[model samples]
Target: MAFAGMLNDEDVRAAVKACQVPGSFDYKLFFTRVGLSARADVQGQRVFNILDRDQSGFIEEEELKLFLQNFSLGA
Candidate 1:
C-alpha cells in the first residue's frame, strides 16, 4: 500500500482504542485519525471506498468499527 508509510501503528492503535462506541467510529473521526481530513474529496472517497467493505456507498457503523481489523489484523 502506497500510504503505508504515512501511517503510524501506534496512532492507529490509539484511534481504535479511542472509539467511544467500543467498535465503531464516525466518518469524521475515522478520516481525522487516518490522516485523510486534509485530502481532496476524490482522495477521501477513495479511502472511504476501500473501507466501505460492503459496496453499499457508505461506511456503515459496523464497517467503520472494523476499519482497523479489515486493513491490518494486528492493529
Candidate 2:
C-alpha cells in the first residue's frame, strides 16, 4: 500500500500478525506511550489538546503531521 515507502513487507506483516493475536495488544500502554493518558477516554479532548502543538484550539496540518510522525506513520 501507500505506506510501502515507510514500511517494509515484514513490518506490515508483523503489525497484521500482532492484531491477529488475541489479547496481544495493550491499548492502554500504547496510548500512554504516545503522550496520552489511558485513564481517560481514548477520544477525549485531552488527546486532542495534546495533538494541538500550537495550542491554537484547532489542529492544523503541521500539527497533524507531527502527531502522525510520533507514531512513525510517515508525515
Candidate 3:
C-alpha cells in the first residue's frame, strides 16, 4: 500500500490495532485514517487487509465468510 503523501504505515497499524479490542472497531476512524469515503468505496483487497487484523496479509476463509455474513452478503 502506497501512502503517496496520504498516510504512513504507522497510521494503518494504529487503526488496525485499535480494532484489536473486543467490539472496539471504529469504522469511522479507520476509514478516515485510510482516506476512504466509505466502506462501499473500499476495494476488496483493502477490505480484506483491514479485516485481517493481525497484519498477516492473508484473510482466512472463515474470516471472509463472517465478514460477508456481517454485510448480509450471505456468502
Candidate 4:
C-alpha cells in the first residue's frame, strides 16, 4: 500500500491540476503551514484563509515560496 503521505500528495497534485485551488502552493507546502498531515479538504480550508494573508484566497506565488522556506515540516 502506498504511504498515507503519498496519497495525500496525489490528492493534492490532482487538486492542483484541476485548478480547484489557486496559487502554486501545492499540497505539501500547504500541509506544513497549517500543521496538517492529510489533505482533509473541507477540514483544511479553515486555515487556508490565514495563509492567504491578504484575504485574497489566492496566495501570491512569491509569498508561498517564502512561507515554505520558513516552515520545517517533518519527514
Each prediction's TM-score versus the true structure = 0.60, 0.41, 0.37, 0.38
Per-residue lDDT of candidate 4, residues 1-75 (tens digit): 212333344443443444434454456654553346554665456445545767787877655554443432211
Give the lowest summed-lDDT range of ten residues in model 4: 66-75
Assess candidate 3 and give its lDDT. Answer: 0.55
**How high a TM-score does candidate 1 get?**
0.60
lDDT per residue as tens, model 1, 1-75: 434655566666667666646445565785588677877888767777777779999877677557677455643
Ranked candidates (TM-score, high to low): 1, 2, 4, 3
Instruction: Go through the candidates in order and give each one's C-alpha lDDT.
Output: 0.66, 0.51, 0.55, 0.48
Q: List model 3 lDDT by residue over 1-75, tens digit each.
A: 332344445655655665666666566776676555443544535655766867787866577446434433433
Cα lDDT tens digits, model 2, 17-73, are 444445554545434443345345545566566767688999786875565454445
Clashing pairs in 1: none
For model 2 the TM-score comes to 0.41
Measured on C-alpha atoms, candidate 1 has an lDDT of 0.66
Name the regions of candidate 1 deviating beyond 4 angstroms: 1-7, 20-26, 70-75
* Candidate 4 Cα lDDT to native: 0.48
| Candidate 2: pairs in clash | none
